[model samples]
Target chain A: MSAVAQAPGPARFCLVLLRRQLTLAVRRPIEIGNPLLFFAMVVALFPLGLGPAPDQLAGFAPGILWIIALLSNLLTSDTVFRSDFEDGSLEQLLLAPQPLFLSVLAYIGAHWLLTGLLLALVSPVFALMLNLSAPAVGVLVASLLLGTAVLSLVGGIGAALTVGLKRGGMLISLLILPFYMPVLIFGSAAVRNAVLGIPATPYLAIIAAMLCLAIALAPLAIAAGLRISVDA
Target chain B: MWSFFHKLGSPPWLYRIAGTILRWLLPVTIVALCVGVTWGLLYTAPDFRQGNSYRIIYIHVPAAAVALAGYYVMAIAGAVSLIWKMKMADVAMKSCAPIGAALTFIALVTGSIWGKPTWGTWWVWDARITSMLILLFLYLGVVALYEAYDNKEAAGKACAVLTLVGMVNIPIIYKSVDWWYSLHQPASIKMTGDTTIDPSMLYPLLLMIASFYALFTCCLLMNMRAEILEREARTGWVKKLALGYRS
Candidate 1:
């Protein structure tokens, strides 16, 4: 498809908007806090629901952590375009001389910085509370760091695609979940395998590969989807 | 270039062409599905080990196979429509999504049912089944995204982008069986392997696969026609077509 053929200096464009998005994210600490809060609350719920047995708690720790990570990612995914789209801010940016794909990537990058990194960093205290081993905590944090960035990038595709739709949250999950399966499967599996004292190298490698592919592919798709949604 | 754009933008012409395809595809699908499923269920005997439950392969294999293939087609169609500005392609993509979702649902339900008798469990987190569940979610996402917007074009593009991005997972879904600790059997339709089961089971599966492909074509055509008709009804071409005017 000529979708990529018309791309205009993707590198410079990506950086220009990437800086802008990063600046915007830094300006809004509260925005990043929501998912972090969601992640904490979700992880905390497990102990309340099932009384904390250190051994029992440790067994369920990896899965609960990953599922919360997915949900928090999902919660933030809906915002990919809602504010800019509603305020006509996105239109102003699109009207800027900046390349469209760069703008799209910037949006995705800010989303990653805002939600993904924050989620990874905030996970440690939760890990300590959950009785997860230090090694398990390391695996959980590392995977979320890698996996959530991938999630934000990919989830941004769903958000961008559905930016113009009214009931976008539900649709975003629909579009995002399939792409997320392997990441979730390999990602959580990695942590679980680690907790079980097995080598998680293979699963981590899969998550890294998934992140690479999603980083390469999703930006273009999101840009294209944004253009079409905006045009309509 | 202008002519191509004009033709592509023409709703009536697309609807008419899709209608023509639908007329023939329906009968062909019905006939093919009937024969294939009959041969699979009645003629094909049970496996020596799996017994009668192996018959579930008649629906399970075909549904799962078509579900994957259908996603590629649907997503690619979404990409084409969004990129090339083809209205017919968008219609085809939208129509196929729900059908694909239904097929995925069929695959999951039948897989679980088959598992109950074979594996003695209602569900397993094996790679294959999990991936299939994810595929169903993908379909749901496309269909939901498509229906979310009031704007036809926006929905199409959104769903299209989602589809293309989601295509990255299809390979994993295919290989999940080999990758995970699943209870499901390996591929029955492999191109270059020694036969795992006897010739009797394989042939029926082949028939079912073929029939499912044919049925898929018919359903896809029907859905496309319906979508095109709904979208194009306000246009002049649709008016003429509705009136049955040739010229």
Candidate 2:
């Protein structure tokens, strides 16, 4: 029983971290909703700018949605470490006894849950509005589910790297957006494949592979970046 | 052997050695570059298909190759700095970015020129060219990140992590873009591989490639020397060097 109790230590720490992050996010509802709002507004602008031609909008829908999702994720990710760093919680996290890696994961997981997951959930409405085919909507959601996790993970690295900078607003995007290109390419490709009546499984699998890679490697970078920022 | 690495960590030793290497390397690079360019331009026969436009390969291919290789050099230096906390490695890593960016820019411009003549467009989103462009952005990102931070030490560590991350992504980006390009269009630039070039053309191309590498080394060393001097401006060796210049 004691061994069982001790074994959940890492899990418990991660949960507490996740809960803390989510609670903080909940307290600031506007911040939590900003990415989704951006997603919707950007999605709306496409139709307005490109015209009401349903076929043209539908043809562009996958790329458009994926690009907007990428942007929202990029923008929100800048704040992931900012508040903590500014308030000195990041310093405490660095000096804490538990592994910084798991805590960093929990922070990034909360970010994804708040921003990317919400974006994926709301993407279908925009997808339908953009006239994306019904079959492709599921692929869009799945791609976002996997792709945004990768984005949050990768973007967390950029955020951690730039958190110490005073004017990191635009720099984080410049740093991480190129990294987002692959996710965008594969995610949109998956949706496009589904729209064309082809199998999107391969692209989704690649995204999954990317997610696995990010999960295994990105926290180390986040941990390193956090330490560097804290030291700064 | 271990002592040599420890010596490498010393800024003055590195500064002096880099100067010695540049003394011999710079002239060799310039002479080879001139010879290679003259040979490539005047000596090689025009392509039956591309005509004179094909001569740009001597510049384009070498620039692209060196640009890609420079990223690895920068990343390796970043890794060294991160792992060993070697300040000279940080200097080397910092110096590599702008030079790499410049080379990548050259590759893109020359490729664009080559494209206008061969493909009748300034750009076509070809796989190699697209990847090279991304490489330029990656270099610029590192430079921007380094400059954004007020703390130089922390900036070094951050840039190190970013460069390592970029290094891991380069192969994936290259492959994905290659796949993307192939899917969208047939192989457009077949001037190099579809048909083998004669020895007459290949020789100067090889020389140009070698000289370009030497050029990269020279530029990298010179950049590192300048960076070291600036970074150690208040140090004794630099102060003495500055006084000597003044005297």
Candidate 3:
């Protein structure tokens, strides 16, 4: 009874929320595997569509890989708040003592862990399959690592805004894809620079800067969006 | 000042004020647009390098300028609406979206028309052009999100949040031509440096730019007036106005 009376601090609540999200995702293993399968299938299609030319595939691989990563992130973002919202836990979270800002970040952090982290980890295999140069593979992974965090954050804003709408899947892309452009531009540029033997740090640095900006700002928007969605 | 802001929140007061302002400003805007267009198209001397094809700058530059500025106006109004719960600002922000989108479309189309004669292509993925296209998407996104929601009030708040998120793109669009090496020319009218354009061309461009700003204001107020009426259709004053118009 005493334990129930003592509310967790914001940080503690966020950790608990994050762990709950990860455990929920872990139980549904198919959710973890869908984006990766989508990535591989799309990578296969590029070679078939553009022809079986190795040189062409290798040349286009950096852009191709980055675009697929972005699309996958976009697809998964719509589901971030979806199940919670459907189950009404989202309202409980909103009414909790912890700041919604940190709570929203916890949701986004879990999303990044499930989607972006796994995508970044497995991107090198897809990069090699597309014949992307060995040196650029590291940059591709690194760029996706930094870039997808920003994507997930931005995507959280869209998901939060549209979580109450019935047909939110298509509309979510329209709402947030423009916000995704900078990440796409710098992410692909970093990998492309690596392919050409140029210093990719500047591009990666710019993405890192964008990540900082998104981290600081996106949660506020998400919290507002969630409030509005819940109220509506 | 507080009373004035209080008055702004009243829908009937805003509707009447917007109508009054639009009556005079709309005519002046039309006149200035005509003079500016004629002055640009007929009075200005041809460019030595590109000949008359360069005249499209009169429309292209001003539209792009105002379209960029309109996003800030929308975002600021959104901020006001969000911060103070101002319904008039919500109307203003909502109104800005279609106007900004139309202006952005004009900028892109005029740019493409100019491109065909100057760059010898209908389009290129140049930095400035791409950024402007993204600006159009941002505006349309607000409109789409607004229409998607079942509740109008929630729609306004959602769009406010979205606009604030998309506001980061504005500075990037402004700096794209400078930041990237592209076929698009840099700004000729400098605030603190020598103006590159001739005075004859500069004067009409200035007039056009001013007219475009006025045009934006007129359109925004008119849009707000319409939105105000639609939103307030259930109110007593609106019904009174409707009956008064009939009699």
Candidate 4:
């Protein structure tokens, strides 16, 4: 949708945005590292609280993992748009020769680069600590991969909506947590099924369906939120 | 009609209308509710299976019905505000949030109460009940989002957008019970003419529905009036009305 006429293709847009975010993360390792560490810490805490018994930890693994996922995803949401918002970069990004929506999309796409895939990659390390079985680990990794992309998308809307407010972190959580129920339900359920050695495929399919819906819907909602923020 | 619509949008006009109606309607609402509730409970024969506990339907059904309708009121108000840029529409939408929330809570609590008597448990993830609970969360989310922002108008718009987005939950809540009918047990009391429910139970239930509607209109008008008065207090007409207060 950019007017540059360099090449009107989806690949260029996705790759460019994705690469930009990744490059930014590579430049600032701490930004990427902090949320992931928080996630791992949260996951590790549950087993300690429950004691060292593998069976005890294993039984609660799905709930523990998903809750950690929720909190860290929430923690990451706070930083998603605030820096650009305060620094006037958001304006530059919006006023880019490209479509404003694309830039917003790019910003969140970059966010997923650091948060989603990275979280997925590191989940296995913590998954073992929680004593999650191999199959359940697979579902946990996949759910974060898909679900946090949805979260980033949804949180982008919340961030944009509340960008101008002081202390929006708590408010954003309140607004988004209820909406995140399906993700929590399906994600944890999928992992539980995998733990049981059930097919787990149906649950995965539903997560996929939810992700597709969010991918389709959330950007438009975020864009609308940005417009409202602009109006005020 | 145009003049009537214009006058209704005016706070002073609304206050007068609401005041006049409140004087009569409040008593009528209480009387109707008392009659509806009394007849539904005492006159109607108890269910063969659910028995006297089935009487819970009198409160439960009306609250559920009103809560569902209350959401539509809020949504339509949101839509109007978004499209027409009407300040009063924003007020109506904002006011509807808390009222709808309370009614939804009532529905949920009464459902749980009814469940204890019939289902032998305090809770089940029944489709209808879950949907109603979702409705409550959606209502709370809207109210929370609106109050969260530093800027009032922006908060209104943000909440308006959220309400429209969350309206999907409404239909989901409604049909969820029906869609998962196999998984979710069917409704015990049917509204339509059927072999099961006796007529004595039905009339008072209908009265409660009417009372709930009247109550909603009464509270909604009161809220909208307060909003109009607060927002318009600085205006010339509002000063004239405010200064004219006799007592």
**Please, what is the whole-model Cα lDDT of each candidate in the order they appear?**
0.78, 0.91, 0.90, 0.78
Model 4's DockQ? 0.38
**TM-score, structure 3 vs. true:** 0.95
Candidate 3, residues B1-247, lDDT tens digits: the string is 9999999999988888888899899999999999999999999999887799989989999999999999989999999999999999999999999999999999999989988877788996666677889899999999999999999999999999999887875574345333433312354321213537899899999999999999999999999999999999998889989888631
Model 2, runs deviating above 4 Å: A1-8, B187-193, B245-247
Q: Which candidate is the best by TM-score?
A: 2
Q: Which lDDT tens digits does candidate 1 get at residues A85-182?
A: 88788777677665666677777887888888888888888887888888878888889999998888878877777787777777777677767666
The TM-score of chain B in candidate 4 is 0.87
- Model 1 has a DockQ score of 0.58
Interface RMSD of 1: 2.0
Docking class of 4: acceptable
Clashing pairs in 2: none
Model 4 Cα lDDT, one tens digit per residue, B72-97? 88888888888877667788898899
Candidate 1 - CAPRI tier? Answer: medium
Summing lDDT over every window of 10 consecutive residues in candidate 1 chain A, give the lowest-scoring window. Answer: A3-12
In candidate 3, the second chain superimposes onto the true chain B with a TM-score of 0.91
Least lDDT summed over 10 consecutive residues: which range in candidate 4 chain B?
B176-185
Per DockQ, the best of the predicted structures is 2
| Docking verdict class for candidate 2 | high
Model 4 error, position B74 (Å): 1.5
DockQ of each: 0.58, 0.80, 0.62, 0.38
Over B13-89, each residue of candidate 2 has an lDDT whose tens digit, in order, gives: 99999999999999999999999999999988899988988999999999999999999999999999999999999
